[model samples]
Target: MKDQAKLASDPADWSIVETVDAVCAGHASALEVTQAVLDRIARRQPVLNCFIRIDGDRALETASGLDAARSAGRTQGPLHGAVLAHKDMYYRAGLVSTCGSEIRRDFVAQTTATVLDKLDNAGAVDVGTLNMSEFASGPTGHNLHHGNCHNPWNPDHITGGSSTGSGSAVGGRLVAGSLGSDTGGSVRLPAGICGAYGIKPTQGRVSRHGVMGLSFSLDNVGPIARTARDCARMLSVIAGPDPMDTTALPVPVDDYEADLDAGVTGLRIAVPKTYYFDDISPEISKLLDSALAVFTSLGAKIVHVDLPHHDIIGALGNAVGSSEQCTLHDFWHQTCPEKYAPLIRARMQAGFGVTAVEYLKALHLRSSIARAVSDAAFGDADVMFLPVLRFPVPTLSETDVGDGAGLHEILGSINHCTRPINYLGFPALTVPCGFSASGLPVAFQLAGPAFSERRLFRFAGAFEAANGLSDCVPDLP
Candidate 1:
């Protein structure tokens, strides 16, 4: 093993697995690793604006305790001493969870989130809360509350959101992994745009108890990390049925890391014939083709299929999501509507016109739509492939539609490829595929049937092994 100081000297170069192995085996003390990360965060946070808070003192104290336990010969979990940050939504008892809104700027949680509790029990350290879209409403990463999170690749460009901080922080190597919720494209979009790996577990795969609610019917919790294996490790720790969240699926959680090295030798990957590719730019299309070529070279078969419901899925998903958002913020809408950013407030009000019958109709059709799409998409394939963004990563100025006449259309366009999956309750993984003409990252999403996260991870792992894109990180100034 390398000298403890030398190895821990640059925490950015270490993966979550490598960090854990070093801390557990005494190659580096947890406190030393934590200090390295704190130093890195200190340097990067000012430019990236990724974190809403920096809990350095608490993180160091916790890491010191973990080191003492290791000296006492206590067994450590897989995460041991890995430092992580999460979108400012997950609740920790007695701690402020801003949720990226002035409405709850000082809101302290009464109970801890189930996912955070699980990660804590697994020996991970929570360094702080990452910035996010106010109330997780906007898809463009614009938070009038906490300044927009800048992309590490180009500070002038936008870091896709509402998981803006998670993606920026991880891509900047401030942390190896972080938790981000996906309501529409929160997890996948930021990760894809920022050149990292993230997975939106199937709806109900991870418990949402004590997490801020966005759209109950569409909200999902997942992790964004530097590599597929890191994302897999975090997912394995946080996914499972919980007594606190009755919506969490009751099935046994699969050992996500056990099948990571299993390559996609004979896997069938479906490519959509329409909708997803409609507005894709030539550069992005070329990159997607190159990615497909890489898969073919690896012995994976790419099959083209005409996915059903391309025309209505987006609108239906919006209906369901907006309706639920309105319901959750009903009181706030009435009392302090002025507190919300105009764009978000208008977005929430879009639900006001949804007749009860219309909302019910959307809910009633969810299962049927999911089944039909699954049959069409996965009927002859193991998983479906789509681009995370149809165009190059946009700059903050380019996407800052604000409360204009085109707000809905702009926001809708940004999340077109990802929201439908939430409606279908399927798992999707985003892996960096290439860089765009502007030098920003481009990525592809692999989605599978409900609760098929293992397959998504397996497919992503193979791509990461082949392209080595996961090893790529933006040069931070």
Candidate 2:
């Protein structure tokens, strides 16, 4: 499998597919790719605070072994030698899975996360776990415990959370990609603000076993990368049914890249007329309009659709997620409430005030709400167009919703467009479309029905080509 030339010396310049091809074909050894990534991490870590730790020694050892296997004329899997990391929530046996909380700061796991296992089986190297918002609760990237993850584009601005490190690492080109769990817009928010591509598959598409549960019903495991194709490749490797997780679907996983370039001709794309664009600034609105034009230019039909309950959908979903999160962290809340961040602790405490009848009602209404939103948003469309953030990326101090300086209103608007998708349990893709006035990244979302990752990727890949935004990388000062 030897080839003509090596990939770039810096892993920051290589995408997942490029690294895989270069390593497997002998144009570049796995160690070379691993070393390049480690080097980039070393250079960027201090500035970005993206990683809680770096398992550089283990990554190098793994890379050397993979190189040996290739030399012995054996290839393990599709992602052989490609480097990737994940948020701190994904457990690794014998390693600390902080879940970005003081309560579990020193806690190590006895079992490895199924998602991490799948990535290993596919030959992807796990470099380390990333920093995240405490227990995946916050929308902004503020973490009093682990330190906030800084945006690579402008460290002063927020990276968005709780997948802060996943987005920063990929957008900063420290690694090809990383895995993130989205209970509320955890994955998509960072992907948007960091100017990267992220996909949160259907709730049942990927297993959540071995991953710390924030909101069991709302939790979803997915990938964040520099492009939709990279996301598709990772999703193909990590998605599918798991015996370990009954919530995982029995439906077969499709080849996400198969039709990535398939023209969007005659494809129906829906745009919401209700809550998505409400209160958004002119700059963000203009960016969305420009993106819609690109979709039309790609021969996709833009159809108007409105989810009448988008307002209630987000709030109701929050109530359900908050209740579920309380159940998961109940022990800690009862025994050592002092361990949690003040704001997160308060939210957890609020969950107890939610009576059994209220929680049951939310759960009972969940299905009907999901169906209604699905019908309104995806009933007649192949893909739905939505906004990620309504305004320019705010400074870290401005969006600290816990500080109680009018940030609640800012935080309220941030998730109305994303949490509703989680409630519906559908797959949503966030791809960078343009930049806000502050020069921070701006992105639009495309979602499809349950387990429709292929359709989302097809649209995302097409829009990526038309928009030409994925190739732009952050130039950290």
Candidate 3:
């Protein structure tokens, strides 16, 4: 096992640029890069517990085959030989597809997820499965089923979830990129806390065919990567209609990497002045101010907007999510309640109490809230900018661990800026903005209306290029 501290300090050793350059120049084989990732997993897994399972032998075999084919002048896909991992919630045939809960710990999928198949076809090798929040239920990243995933930046701090391990793995540089499911900021919140880039695509933009569903209506799968270009590359492979999922839109895939260098000139960016900024830490607020300044310098018009129904959006999102989750696990809870974590069982039980009328009312409120937010905040802008999480990452020791009032407050605060977008089914991207005073990372979020992913990427990429923040990497243990 390699020393993680040594690997963490050596930025040049971990840069994706060097890995790709080596492969292209024939100085290193993709098999070798894959092997290195596997080796790092072995070295770091004990301390990080980032992976649920490591298919090192299969990964090496596939990488070697790809290298041999490429050497023989055979063409490969865009992501040829890139080492990748995904949250364990993604169903890969014959692999255990646990949603980080005891009930489904041994559940195996007969078929692979659409996103998994797409990535494999693109020539990305799956090295392992990353950890995640149980059933994608909580936001603080504490999982009673598989232990909490610690932040790579500061091990004492929490890695925001339910995409806990996906964020930690990418932040820890254990793999090139990973996929995480975001229902209500599962992807972006962790990415923000861990200093990575994450995208929560529009609902129905990507197929949810084989993913473990928490909320069928709000669930979205997206990439978490070290850089914006890498995320775009992965999205290119995974973004398309799937015959298995009728709800998936047949939207055309655009090249997210093409206009990355193009500045955000003549772009209208909205900065909401109400709920989004309220109760945020002063340091985080300052970092957002600095980010807005960078956009202003890049010739983007920044306008202040308002969202009055933000509180309603949050409440409605919880109602919808809890109801959907209850429906998914009703049989399991009824038959084998002991298998579920206590907190999850309680949450699932709460759904049973929601009346049909209440559910309908919540749905109606969701629609109205979405319309109000769109009209007030997004009417004049290409996208709206906000924080991914309300504050810096919390220490693992400090967050609530049980289903109590403190736990609710912790979870709600973590999802404060994110739940509304999920309820509205909008697309969002989170990119690192600056570091907190304690040296933890803080992120700024950008969101737009449905199917506005390309524009979101364009604006985010432009902001990334101008700020040059992605170059900052954390020192791992």
Output the number of the TM-score-best candidate: 1
Score candidate 2 by lDDT. 0.86
Please give, for residues 26-86, the per-residue lDDT of candidate 3 as tens digits.
6567887887788777777776677888889989998888799779876367777678889
Model 3 regions lying over 4 Å from their true place: 1-25
Candidate 2 lDDT, 1-477, residue by residue in tens = 332333444655788888888888888888988888898898899989999989999999999999999999998788899899999999999999888988889999999888899999888999999999899887788889989899989999999888999988988889889998898899999999999999989988998989999888899998999988889999999898999999888889999998889979999999888788788889999999999898889998988987866657766776788788888888888899888888778656667777787778878888887788788877788888989998888889777767454544576666667888898888999989998777899998898888788988998888888778766778863
Each model's lDDT comes to 0.90, 0.86, 0.82
Q: What value does the lDDT take at residue 297 in candidate 3?
A: 91
Least accurate stretch of 10 residues (summed lDDT) in model 2? 1-10
Q: Please rank every candidate by lDDT, starting with the best.
A: 1, 2, 3
For 145-255, candidate 1 gives per-residue lDDT tens digits of 889899999999988989999999998899989999999999999999899999999999999999999998899999999989899999999999999999998989998
Q: Clashes per prediction?
A: 0, 0, 0
Give the per-residue Cα lDDT of candidate 2 at 54. Answer: 95
C-alpha positional error of residue 108 in candidate 3 after TM-score superposition, expressed in Å = 1.8
Give the per-residue Cα lDDT of candidate 1 at 349. Answer: 96
For each candidate, give its TM-score against the true structure. 0.98, 0.97, 0.94
